[model samples]
Target: MRIATTAEDHRIAVLAALAIAIHVLETALPSPIPGIKPGLANVITVLVLLQFGWHTAAWVTALRILAGSLVIGSFLSPTFLLSAAGAGLSLAMLGLAWRLRLGLTAIGLSIVAALSHMLGQFLLAWWLFIPHPALFKLLPVLLTFAMIFGVLSGTIAAMIHRRLTIGTHQT
Candidate 1:
């Protein structure tokens, strides 16, 4: 049976556009380190997860990563592989966090996913490209960036979620 377009489809399209835009923009910016990025696109992921569901967030992330790489010409390259792995791992952790449903809010889940994403990318990079002990040396710097950006993204996600919830209630 053919699936019909619904409000959820519209939401995914809009969210995907927002995420891909952020991803492409971020790719254009210069970073101090090779793999260190703020992952501002994560804000959309968190918003979708909290507002819609994990499946919605997954669609957004997959489309963002794939389309962002194609737009930036990183498709099927090591960069794409690393990005895909990190996103996969982060999404896994997000699903787990949501299922657990502890007191952990978006901030907590974002931090968890951010750290996992960083570690996943690092490990994949080491195995697929570096294959040297020195690869581990970058862990500290990457993790530091991850923690900082994680908090920032989470805080932004939280604020956005709050506004969305309030707006819905007021409607």
Candidate 2:
């Protein structure tokens, strides 16, 4: 493991900012599948996890969710709660995957993380917003897309990380 220096911290901050910007863009985009998103932001989270550590990645995830909510004016709503839950669960999964040395490809890790995130969000919604169990029926469809998009985003992130590492010494 590498100790993060001032330079690394600055780099992480820039990455986080880019992640947040991507989150905002995703939030603004219209999706044919309701509540389904490309989750482009996770690309940064995975990069953060790989480059820094799960702790820093967790912080980034939380900050992204909180700041994103405020920026979108959904801070006080149920949506915010859902987002927070999803972020927390996904961070936990990402950390566990790292610690266990899952050896999963980036796409696999992203799929696992995204699935956990969606499960967390849907569970929260079912518990707090929906009065019936039928709400869960919609999850399969949502999860399918989440898996696909997660892989796509993760692959893109992995590629970017690879490209960024070229000719650059690792910290």
Candidate 3:
């Protein structure tokens, strides 16, 4: 039992490392819009959700958010707050998807998570930062980008999952 728990911890650490790397890399990229990010890290998050479970995914995401923010010098800043909100919303959405368990594959859950994350961040900005009705105007743009990036990230996750599963089966 101890060995199994250790293995699980190791798995979570590895997943968190991958997610943190991706998150940091994405943070370095120049966004076309203030809130528009490719969210490539979400690929790993969704993969974790599908392969392990929501708890593992949550661990990976939380680590990524914390470590990524620390590395980028945004710890405890507004940037960190937004990142936390997005990740929290993403995990919540994934949790709901897992509970529903209605034959929704990783791709579907990825889309749902992505949309929820974006909505959460946008809402946070409107409520805490801007507090203006004009902030709501960005909804369409944010949702559109979220949908596109979600599909792309989901496709990437599916491919990685396919390759990993194939390799395991072959071994």
Per-model TM-score versus the true fold: 0.94, 0.89, 0.94
Local accuracy of candidate 2 as per-residue lDDT tens digits, 114-139: 88899889888888888597887898
| Model 2 deviation from native, Cα RMSD in Å | 4.2
Return the lDDT, model 3, position 51.
85
Worst lDDT 10-window in candidate 2: 162-171
Residue 63 Cα positional deviation in candidate 3, in Å, after optimal superposition: 0.5
Worst 10 residues of 1 by lDDT: 101-110
What does candidate 1's lDDT look like per residue over 21-100, in tens digits? 99999988899888888999999998899988899999999999898999999999999999999999999999988888
Which of 1 and 3 is the better model by lDDT? 1
At residue 158, give the lDDT of candidate 3.
Answer: 89
Q: What is the lDDT for 167 in model 2? A: 38
RMSD, one per candidate, in order? 1.7, 4.2, 2.5
How far out, in Å, is residue 11 in model 1? 1.4
Deviation (Å) of 82 in candidate 2: 0.8
The 0-to-1 C-alpha lDDT of every candidate, in the order given, reads 0.91, 0.83, 0.88
TM-score between model 3 and native: 0.94
lDDT of 2: 0.83
